[model samples]
Target: MQHSKLLYEKGILHNKKMLTQSQYSNFKFVARLDQIKTFTAGIKALLFAEHGAFMINEDGFTCTVEQGKCIQASLFMMPACFSEFYVDGVVHFNVNMNVLNECLSIFAGIDCTMKMLYKGPEAPLILVLEPQDECEISTECSIKTTAQEEPMEYSLDDNSSSLNVIFIRGPDLSNIFQEFDKSTEELEITISPRRPHFKIDTLGVMQSESSIEVAKSSDMILMFNCRETTKARYKSSLVRMTQKALSVASKVAIKTDLSGLMEMHFMLQDDSQAEVYIQFFITPLAEMD
Candidate 1:
């Protein structure tokens, strides 16, 4: 809950001579975590892509990964998840997620504290980990970082006329995905104001289909708002990428706009019960003639 001002001030003063005032003020991040598992869990959820852009700000840390220019996923870690969190303005950089995950898991199954520091875009991401039970052993890792490129934009227009929103408990929604046939190639989602208010259908490779329906009066559905009947189709594989987050989430929100762009928001809690979030944006598959 407290910022490590002394450490950041010292790090800034040391780099002041090497960097210009403007450059030094642009990117500087320092975060410490007593619960290493919390950080690792978040990174592991978005490991579908090897490389991801890390955006740090006063709010917390967010890592975004995009695939095939059609699907994007982000993992958000709030300040409460860290023992010491500090950032100078907003910082953006790219990192190898696989390597970072491995480094954090090195001391797995043990109680360890982590300190992460990034001086600027050019500097490597430095990680310091020390086991709480072991006094003499410690590890320091410096992972290479790259300049961030322009990320793909995929956001739903809130003012659209065809917008639909659904809120459901995470476990209930996750059960639907878990029951899906693995051989399916496409997933179709339908939301209507009539009976069977929400439905999910899948088409398999063997010319077979599966469907699951949830009524508006169902206990699992917290809220359902639909202006009209709306349906969209997306790649089943792309939609399954949320399994990691869904396994740990407590609640989820499903939204869709007029363009058929789908957005899913998942809420998770760490060891200390601090809320964390994961978001996925998926573009609908093109219609066949």
Candidate 2:
């Protein structure tokens, strides 16, 4: 597996034109997929926003969406997800998520091969779909693209800051979230090295409070590393944005820094064992007196 890095730097665009003329003769990026369901699943998870930045590199493809400037979600599809993937250097563009989703799902319940092509930053993304069972059926779609915007910076330095990390099975975490009160306005998370190692508290709109505590010895907890007791409050709506990804993930690793930034990595694996990942970064809500 290739190591993937975030290519969100503005300076990287300067290198786009340096590609050889031969590369320009062909599309800057081209990818083929035979398993459309797996690809659509990841895309649907990041559809929280209307438009998103689409990035492709030698490693794979990534789509990122941000909401309220405090919450950001990214979906990564590795090269293994595509039958054929090629990129000159790195390509970044913006596209409408709803349009792309609809195009990909046009032939529902049918096995189809999808081919995607992008000539350059200014060119529209072209998708060609052909039913495998019926050679006569084919569809082509052209979705307009726009310049990429600077990605939001929401990173946590795990080594320098006092951090707490927890690994949990996806289904277990999903079940826990399902129990949260839907009318809650705030979700408070507390982690400690002592008893009731992990806890969640919610304050409803009516000011009613609910709390849940999990023991460190619980079977659902795969690993727990707590440097110190830490507690933070986050917007309930923002935290609930992860439900789609959580429903499909097999495992999840959550990390929180002293600054109250929360990061979660949700891992999804298909029947073929190919892995897809969805990540979320959330900023804590300000406290009141």
lDDT by residue for model 2 over 152-183, one digit each (tens)?
A: 98888869547999998999999999998899
Off by over 4 Å in 2: 1-25, 109-111, 131-135
TM-score of candidate 1 relative to the true fold: 0.87
Clashing pairs in 1: none
The per-model lDDT (C-alpha) reads 0.82, 0.82
lDDT per residue, candidate 1, 1-289, as tens digits?
0113333354633442223344435449878788687567667888999798999998889899988788888988888888777789898999999999888888875868887879887888878787878756767777899999757878877887788999999999989899988999999999888977999989999969989999988999999988888888999999999888888888889999657889999888777677678999989998921
For candidate 2, which ten residues in a row score worst on lDDT?
Answer: 1-10
Give me the candidate number with maximum TM-score: 2
**Native-to-model Cα distance after best TM-score fit, residue 125 in candidate 1, in Å:** 0.6
Candidate 2's C-alpha lDDT? 0.82
Structural similarity to truth (TM-score) of each candidate: 0.87, 0.87
